[model samples]
Target: MRNLKRLSIGPIDLDVAGGEIIALTGPSGAGKSLLLRAIADLDPNEGQLSLSGEDRNAISAPAWRKQVMYVPAHTGWWADTVEPHFADLSRAHVKNTLQRLGLESTALNWQVANLSTGERQRLALARAMAHEPKILLLDEPTSGLDSENAARAEKLISEIAKSGTGIVFVTHDVAQAERLGTRRLYFYNGGLHEAAP
Candidate 1:
Protein backbone atom coordinates (compact mmCIF):
# COMPACT_ATOMS: atom_id res chain seq x y z
CA MET A 1 0.00 0.00 0.00
CA ARG A 2 1.07 3.55 -0.69
CA ASN A 3 0.95 6.55 1.60
CA LEU A 4 -1.99 8.82 0.87
CA LYS A 5 -1.39 12.37 -0.29
CA ARG A 6 -0.53 15.01 2.34
CA LEU A 7 -3.64 16.18 4.16
CA SER A 8 -4.70 19.81 4.31
CA ILE A 9 -3.42 20.20 7.84
CA GLY A 10 0.20 20.01 6.56
CA PRO A 11 2.70 18.18 4.43
CA ILE A 12 3.01 14.72 6.03
CA ASP A 13 1.71 11.35 4.80
CA LEU A 14 1.66 7.74 6.00
CA ASP A 15 1.41 4.22 4.59
CA VAL A 16 0.56 1.57 7.18
CA ALA A 17 0.07 -2.21 7.01
CA GLY A 18 -1.75 -4.80 9.06
CA GLY A 19 -0.17 -6.60 12.04
CA GLU A 20 2.36 -3.83 12.42
CA ILE A 21 2.87 -1.39 15.31
CA ILE A 22 3.30 2.19 14.16
CA ALA A 23 4.52 4.66 16.78
CA LEU A 24 3.52 8.29 16.36
CA THR A 25 5.68 10.99 18.01
CA GLY A 26 5.91 14.77 17.87
CA PRO A 27 5.68 17.90 20.02
CA SER A 28 2.40 18.91 21.60
CA GLY A 29 -0.21 20.49 19.25
CA ALA A 30 1.51 18.63 16.47
CA GLY A 31 -1.79 16.78 15.76
CA LYS A 32 -0.78 13.25 16.67
CA SER A 33 -4.09 12.63 18.44
CA LEU A 34 -5.90 14.48 15.70
CA LEU A 35 -4.40 12.18 13.13
CA LEU A 36 -5.64 9.15 15.02
CA ARG A 37 -9.08 10.70 15.35
CA ALA A 38 -9.15 11.39 11.65
CA ILE A 39 -8.17 7.84 10.85
CA ALA A 40 -10.80 6.49 13.21
CA ASP A 41 -13.44 8.77 11.66
CA LEU A 42 -14.02 10.50 14.99
CA ASP A 43 -13.16 13.83 13.39
CA PRO A 44 -13.80 15.57 10.09
CA ASN A 45 -11.13 15.26 7.46
CA GLU A 46 -10.54 15.06 3.73
CA GLY A 47 -8.43 12.13 2.59
CA GLN A 48 -8.44 8.40 2.17
CA LEU A 49 -8.25 6.09 5.18
CA SER A 50 -8.80 2.46 4.46
CA LEU A 51 -8.73 -0.82 6.38
CA SER A 52 -8.14 -4.08 4.52
CA GLY A 53 -8.67 -2.31 1.20
CA GLU A 54 -12.06 -0.90 2.21
CA ASP A 55 -12.33 2.86 2.61
CA ARG A 56 -13.00 4.01 6.17
CA ASN A 57 -15.99 6.11 5.15
CA ALA A 58 -17.68 3.17 3.49
CA ILE A 59 -18.01 1.36 6.79
CA SER A 60 -20.49 2.31 9.52
CA ALA A 61 -18.98 4.21 12.41
CA PRO A 62 -19.91 1.68 15.05
CA ALA A 63 -18.63 -1.27 13.03
CA TRP A 64 -15.43 0.55 12.20
CA ARG A 65 -14.99 1.59 15.82
CA LYS A 66 -15.48 -1.97 17.04
CA GLN A 67 -12.83 -3.24 14.66
CA VAL A 68 -10.53 -0.23 15.08
CA MET A 69 -10.81 0.95 18.69
CA TYR A 70 -9.33 4.13 20.06
CA VAL A 71 -8.33 4.41 23.69
CA PRO A 72 -7.94 8.00 24.78
CA ALA A 73 -5.26 9.38 27.07
CA HIS A 74 -7.70 9.65 29.95
CA THR A 75 -9.79 6.49 30.12
CA GLY A 76 -13.20 6.88 31.70
CA TRP A 77 -14.60 4.88 34.61
CA TRP A 78 -18.31 5.14 35.39
CA ALA A 79 -18.70 2.66 38.22
CA ASP A 80 -17.69 2.23 41.84
CA THR A 81 -15.84 -1.10 41.65
CA VAL A 82 -13.66 -2.21 38.77
CA GLU A 83 -15.37 -5.58 38.64
CA PRO A 84 -18.65 -4.02 37.63
CA HIS A 85 -17.07 -2.36 34.65
CA PHE A 86 -15.63 -5.64 33.57
CA ALA A 87 -18.57 -7.75 34.63
CA ASP A 88 -19.16 -8.82 31.06
CA LEU A 89 -15.53 -9.76 30.61
CA SER A 90 -14.41 -13.37 30.53
CA ARG A 91 -13.01 -14.17 33.95
CA ALA A 92 -9.98 -16.01 32.63
CA HIS A 93 -9.06 -13.25 30.16
CA VAL A 94 -9.56 -10.46 32.65
CA LYS A 95 -7.47 -12.26 35.25
CA ASN A 96 -4.74 -12.95 32.72
CA THR A 97 -4.58 -9.35 31.46
CA LEU A 98 -4.46 -7.94 34.97
CA GLN A 99 -1.72 -10.39 35.90
CA ARG A 100 0.26 -9.47 32.81
CA LEU A 101 -0.07 -5.83 33.74
CA GLY A 102 1.27 -6.59 37.22
CA LEU A 103 -2.07 -6.15 38.94
CA GLU A 104 -3.17 -8.61 41.58
CA SER A 105 -6.40 -10.52 40.99
CA THR A 106 -7.84 -8.75 44.04
CA ALA A 107 -7.67 -5.51 42.15
CA LEU A 108 -10.83 -6.59 40.35
CA ASN A 109 -12.77 -5.82 43.53
CA TRP A 110 -11.13 -2.47 44.22
CA GLN A 111 -13.14 0.74 44.01
CA VAL A 112 -12.34 2.84 40.98
CA ALA A 113 -12.07 5.97 43.13
CA ASN A 114 -9.46 4.29 45.29
CA LEU A 115 -7.24 3.19 42.44
CA SER A 116 -4.24 5.28 41.42
CA THR A 117 -3.75 6.71 37.92
CA GLY A 118 -1.44 3.87 36.96
CA GLU A 119 -3.98 1.31 38.06
CA ARG A 120 -6.66 3.04 36.07
CA GLN A 121 -4.43 3.04 32.99
CA ARG A 122 -3.78 -0.66 33.31
CA LEU A 123 -7.48 -1.32 33.77
CA ALA A 124 -8.20 0.60 30.60
CA LEU A 125 -5.65 -1.44 28.71
CA ALA A 126 -7.19 -4.60 30.03
CA ARG A 127 -10.64 -3.45 29.06
CA ALA A 128 -9.50 -2.66 25.54
CA MET A 129 -7.71 -5.97 25.12
CA ALA A 130 -10.81 -7.84 26.24
CA HIS A 131 -12.62 -6.52 23.19
CA GLU A 132 -10.11 -8.14 20.80
CA PRO A 133 -10.13 -5.35 18.26
CA LYS A 134 -8.11 -5.80 15.07
CA ILE A 135 -6.61 -2.34 15.26
CA LEU A 136 -5.68 -0.45 18.44
CA LEU A 137 -5.38 3.32 18.70
CA LEU A 138 -3.46 4.19 21.85
CA ASP A 139 -2.80 7.73 23.08
CA GLU A 140 -0.01 7.99 25.60
CA PRO A 141 -1.22 4.86 27.38
CA THR A 142 1.84 4.66 29.65
CA SER A 143 2.04 8.35 30.57
CA GLY A 144 1.10 8.13 34.24
CA LEU A 145 2.87 4.98 35.36
CA ASP A 146 5.97 4.37 37.43
CA SER A 147 8.95 2.86 35.64
CA GLU A 148 8.17 -0.69 36.72
CA ASN A 149 4.49 -0.45 35.83
CA ALA A 150 5.32 1.26 32.57
CA ALA A 151 7.62 -1.59 31.65
CA ARG A 152 4.89 -4.08 32.39
CA ALA A 153 2.48 -2.09 30.26
CA GLU A 154 5.03 -2.00 27.47
CA LYS A 155 5.42 -5.76 27.62
CA LEU A 156 1.68 -6.24 27.42
CA ILE A 157 1.60 -4.08 24.30
CA SER A 158 4.43 -6.06 22.73
CA GLU A 159 2.63 -9.31 23.37
CA ILE A 160 -0.61 -7.94 21.95
CA ALA A 161 1.12 -6.75 18.78
CA LYS A 162 2.74 -10.13 18.40
CA SER A 163 -0.76 -11.60 18.41
CA GLY A 164 -1.40 -9.71 15.13
CA THR A 165 -3.13 -6.53 16.25
CA GLY A 166 -2.28 -3.43 14.27
CA ILE A 167 -1.36 -0.72 16.77
CA VAL A 168 -1.15 3.00 16.18
CA PHE A 169 0.44 4.21 19.36
CA VAL A 170 0.75 7.93 20.06
CA THR A 171 3.26 8.89 22.72
CA HIS A 172 5.81 11.52 23.61
CA ASP A 173 8.05 8.81 25.02
CA VAL A 174 10.47 7.93 22.24
CA ALA A 175 12.01 5.06 24.16
CA GLN A 176 8.65 3.44 24.67
CA ALA A 177 7.99 3.78 20.94
CA GLU A 178 11.37 2.30 20.10
CA ARG A 179 10.66 -0.62 22.39
CA LEU A 180 7.12 -1.38 21.18
CA GLY A 181 6.77 -0.20 17.60
CA THR A 182 7.89 -2.21 14.59
CA ARG A 183 7.50 0.90 12.43
CA ARG A 184 7.36 4.59 13.32
CA LEU A 185 5.36 7.58 12.07
CA TYR A 186 5.89 11.16 13.17
CA PHE A 187 2.97 13.57 13.35
CA TYR A 188 3.68 17.24 12.81
CA ASN A 189 1.97 20.30 11.36
CA GLY A 190 -1.29 18.36 11.32
CA GLY A 191 0.08 15.54 9.17
CA LEU A 192 2.22 12.40 9.31
CA HIS A 193 5.82 11.67 8.32
CA GLU A 194 6.96 8.06 7.88
CA ALA A 195 10.07 7.37 9.92
CA ALA A 196 13.19 6.02 8.21
CA PRO A 197 14.84 2.82 9.36
Candidate 2:
Protein backbone atom coordinates (compact mmCIF):
# COMPACT_ATOMS: atom_id res chain seq x y z
CA MET A 1 0.00 0.00 0.00
CA ARG A 2 1.35 3.47 -0.95
CA ASN A 3 -0.19 6.70 0.16
CA LEU A 4 -3.57 4.96 0.42
CA LYS A 5 -6.12 7.13 2.12
CA ARG A 6 -9.87 6.84 2.64
CA LEU A 7 -12.63 7.77 5.05
CA SER A 8 -10.70 9.22 7.96
CA ILE A 9 -7.81 6.95 7.13
CA GLY A 10 -5.24 7.74 4.57
CA PRO A 11 -1.64 8.11 3.57
CA ILE A 12 -1.21 4.52 4.75
CA ASP A 13 2.04 3.29 3.35
CA LEU A 14 3.04 -0.26 4.15
CA ASP A 15 4.37 -3.32 2.43
CA VAL A 16 2.55 -6.59 3.03
CA ALA A 17 4.95 -9.25 1.87
CA GLY A 18 3.71 -12.52 0.48
CA GLY A 19 2.87 -15.07 3.19
CA GLU A 20 2.33 -12.42 5.84
CA ILE A 21 -0.81 -11.85 7.92
CA ILE A 22 -1.47 -8.35 9.23
CA ALA A 23 -4.27 -8.03 11.76
CA LEU A 24 -6.01 -4.70 12.28
CA THR A 25 -7.40 -4.10 15.75
CA GLY A 26 -9.11 -1.08 17.27
CA PRO A 27 -12.32 0.31 18.69
CA SER A 28 -15.41 1.06 16.61
CA GLY A 29 -14.98 3.89 14.05
CA ALA A 30 -11.22 3.72 14.32
CA GLY A 31 -11.16 2.71 10.62
CA LYS A 32 -9.82 -0.82 10.86
CA SER A 33 -12.21 -2.15 8.24
CA LEU A 34 -11.97 1.14 6.41
CA LEU A 35 -8.26 0.63 6.00
CA LEU A 36 -8.77 -2.85 4.63
CA ARG A 37 -11.43 -1.49 2.30
CA ALA A 38 -8.95 1.07 1.05
CA ILE A 39 -6.24 -1.43 0.32
CA ALA A 40 -8.74 -3.65 -1.46
CA ASP A 41 -9.95 -0.59 -3.46
CA LEU A 42 -13.56 -1.37 -2.54
CA ASP A 43 -14.02 2.15 -1.22
CA PRO A 44 -13.01 5.35 -2.95
CA ASN A 45 -9.53 6.14 -1.71
CA GLU A 46 -6.61 8.19 -2.87
CA GLY A 47 -3.05 6.95 -3.35
CA GLN A 48 -1.78 3.78 -4.97
CA LEU A 49 -1.74 0.08 -4.10
CA SER A 50 0.55 -2.39 -5.74
CA LEU A 51 0.92 -6.15 -5.54
CA SER A 52 4.34 -7.67 -6.16
CA GLY A 53 5.32 -4.17 -7.33
CA GLU A 54 2.59 -3.85 -9.97
CA ASP A 55 0.57 -0.68 -9.83
CA ARG A 56 -3.13 -1.06 -9.03
CA ASN A 57 -4.22 1.54 -11.59
CA ALA A 58 -2.54 -0.37 -14.40
CA ILE A 59 -5.15 -3.12 -14.25
CA SER A 60 -8.89 -3.11 -14.70
CA ALA A 61 -10.95 -2.90 -11.53
CA PRO A 62 -12.33 -6.42 -11.95
CA ALA A 63 -8.91 -7.87 -12.71
CA TRP A 64 -7.29 -6.02 -9.83
CA ARG A 65 -10.10 -7.16 -7.53
CA LYS A 66 -9.64 -10.75 -8.63
CA GLN A 67 -6.07 -10.61 -7.37
CA VAL A 68 -6.87 -8.61 -4.24
CA MET A 69 -10.09 -10.19 -3.02
CA TYR A 70 -12.15 -8.58 -0.30
CA VAL A 71 -14.36 -10.84 1.77
CA PRO A 72 -16.99 -8.83 3.60
CA ALA A 73 -18.47 -10.02 6.88
CA HIS A 74 -21.82 -10.94 5.35
CA THR A 75 -21.27 -12.26 1.87
CA GLY A 76 -24.04 -11.80 -0.61
CA TRP A 77 -25.93 -14.89 -1.71
CA TRP A 78 -27.44 -14.04 -5.06
CA ALA A 79 -28.51 -17.57 -5.86
CA ASP A 80 -30.86 -19.92 -4.08
CA THR A 81 -28.44 -22.85 -3.90
CA VAL A 82 -24.83 -22.86 -2.78
CA GLU A 83 -23.61 -24.45 -6.03
CA PRO A 84 -24.85 -21.58 -8.18
CA HIS A 85 -22.95 -19.09 -6.10
CA PHE A 86 -19.83 -20.98 -7.04
CA ALA A 87 -20.79 -21.65 -10.63
CA ASP A 88 -17.29 -20.77 -11.83
CA LEU A 89 -15.79 -23.55 -9.70
CA SER A 90 -16.02 -27.23 -10.57
CA ARG A 91 -18.00 -29.41 -8.20
CA ALA A 92 -14.80 -31.12 -7.14
CA HIS A 93 -13.16 -27.83 -6.25
CA VAL A 94 -16.14 -26.65 -4.24
CA LYS A 95 -16.29 -29.94 -2.43
CA ASN A 96 -12.58 -29.76 -1.70
CA THR A 97 -12.95 -26.28 -0.29
CA LEU A 98 -15.98 -27.34 1.76
CA GLN A 99 -14.01 -30.14 3.37
CA ARG A 100 -11.06 -27.84 3.93
CA LEU A 101 -13.36 -25.59 5.95
CA GLY A 102 -14.58 -28.57 8.01
CA LEU A 103 -17.82 -29.00 6.08
CA GLU A 104 -18.72 -32.31 4.56
CA SER A 105 -18.16 -32.57 0.82
CA THR A 106 -21.89 -32.92 0.35
CA ALA A 107 -22.35 -29.46 1.75
CA LEU A 108 -22.26 -28.25 -1.84
CA ASN A 109 -25.79 -29.52 -2.21
CA TRP A 110 -27.19 -27.43 0.61
CA GLN A 111 -29.57 -24.55 0.00
CA VAL A 112 -28.44 -21.07 0.92
CA ALA A 113 -31.69 -20.43 2.77
CA ASN A 114 -30.92 -23.26 5.14
CA LEU A 115 -27.45 -22.03 6.05
CA SER A 116 -26.96 -20.38 9.41
CA THR A 117 -24.94 -17.17 9.78
CA GLY A 118 -21.82 -19.11 10.68
CA GLU A 119 -22.28 -21.35 7.66
CA ARG A 120 -22.53 -18.31 5.44
CA GLN A 121 -19.39 -16.87 6.95
CA ARG A 122 -17.36 -20.00 6.34
CA LEU A 123 -18.83 -20.50 2.89
CA ALA A 124 -18.04 -16.92 1.98
CA LEU A 125 -14.43 -17.52 2.96
CA ALA A 126 -14.38 -20.62 0.79
CA ARG A 127 -15.68 -18.58 -2.11
CA ALA A 128 -12.99 -15.95 -1.63
CA MET A 129 -10.17 -18.49 -1.67
CA ALA A 130 -11.49 -20.26 -4.76
CA HIS A 131 -9.94 -17.62 -7.00
CA GLU A 132 -6.61 -17.76 -5.24
CA PRO A 133 -6.23 -14.03 -4.63
CA LYS A 134 -2.73 -12.73 -4.16
CA ILE A 135 -4.05 -10.47 -1.40
CA LEU A 136 -6.93 -11.60 0.82
CA LEU A 137 -8.91 -8.96 2.70
CA LEU A 138 -11.10 -10.52 5.36
CA ASP A 139 -13.48 -8.35 7.38
CA GLU A 140 -14.01 -10.04 10.71
CA PRO A 141 -14.22 -13.44 9.00
CA THR A 142 -15.02 -15.45 12.12
CA SER A 143 -17.34 -13.17 14.04
CA GLY A 144 -20.31 -15.42 13.50
CA LEU A 145 -18.57 -18.67 14.40
CA ASP A 146 -18.23 -20.53 17.67
CA SER A 147 -14.76 -21.27 19.08
CA GLU A 148 -14.40 -24.55 17.20
CA ASN A 149 -15.47 -23.09 13.88
CA ALA A 150 -13.40 -20.00 14.47
CA ALA A 151 -10.34 -22.09 15.05
CA ARG A 152 -11.09 -24.02 11.92
CA ALA A 153 -11.40 -20.80 9.96
CA GLU A 154 -8.10 -19.55 11.34
CA LYS A 155 -6.32 -22.73 10.38
CA LEU A 156 -7.71 -22.61 6.87
CA ILE A 157 -6.68 -18.99 6.44
CA SER A 158 -3.27 -19.66 7.92
CA GLU A 159 -2.72 -22.34 5.33
CA ILE A 160 -3.65 -19.88 2.62
CA ALA A 161 -1.22 -17.29 3.93
CA LYS A 162 1.55 -19.84 4.19
CA SER A 163 0.94 -20.72 0.56
CA GLY A 164 2.09 -17.14 -0.33
CA THR A 165 -1.08 -15.10 -0.34
CA GLY A 166 -0.83 -11.94 1.76
CA ILE A 167 -3.65 -11.60 4.27
CA VAL A 168 -5.02 -8.43 5.90
CA PHE A 169 -7.90 -8.92 8.26
CA VAL A 170 -9.86 -6.91 10.80
CA THR A 171 -10.54 -8.45 14.21
CA HIS A 172 -11.77 -7.10 17.51
CA ASP A 173 -10.50 -10.21 19.29
CA VAL A 174 -7.07 -9.52 20.77
CA ALA A 175 -6.46 -13.24 21.26
CA GLN A 176 -7.28 -13.80 17.62
CA ALA A 177 -4.79 -11.12 16.65
CA GLU A 178 -2.08 -12.78 18.69
CA ARG A 179 -2.95 -16.13 17.18
CA LEU A 180 -3.18 -15.12 13.52
CA GLY A 181 -1.31 -11.85 12.96
CA THR A 182 2.23 -12.02 11.68
CA ARG A 183 2.10 -8.27 12.37
CA ARG A 184 -0.48 -6.35 14.36
CA LEU A 185 -1.55 -2.73 14.02
CA TYR A 186 -3.53 -1.09 16.75
CA PHE A 187 -5.83 1.63 15.41
CA TYR A 188 -6.14 4.47 17.88
CA ASN A 189 -6.54 8.25 17.93
CA GLY A 190 -7.69 7.87 14.34
CA GLY A 191 -4.29 6.49 13.42
CA LEU A 192 -2.44 3.22 13.44
CA HIS A 193 0.16 2.13 15.97
CA GLU A 194 2.35 -0.66 14.66
CA ALA A 195 3.50 -3.73 16.57
CA ALA A 196 6.28 -6.16 15.67
CA PRO A 197 5.37 -9.22 13.71
Which one is best on lDDT? 2
Model 2, 7-103: lDDT tens digits are 6786677788889999988888788778877777788989978878889888888998889999988889888888777878767777787787888
TM-score of each: 0.86, 0.94
Q: Give the number of colliding residue pairs in candidate 2.
A: 1
Candidate 1: segments with Cα more than 4 A from true spot: 1-13
For all predictions, the C-alpha RMSD in Å is: 2.8, 1.9
- Candidate 1's C-alpha lDDT? 0.80
Q: Which lDDT tens digits does candidate 1 get at residues 81-181? A: 99987887799998999999999989989998898888998889888887778888999999999999988988888888888888889989888778888
Error of 1 at 36 (Å): 1.5
**lDDT per prediction?**
0.80, 0.86
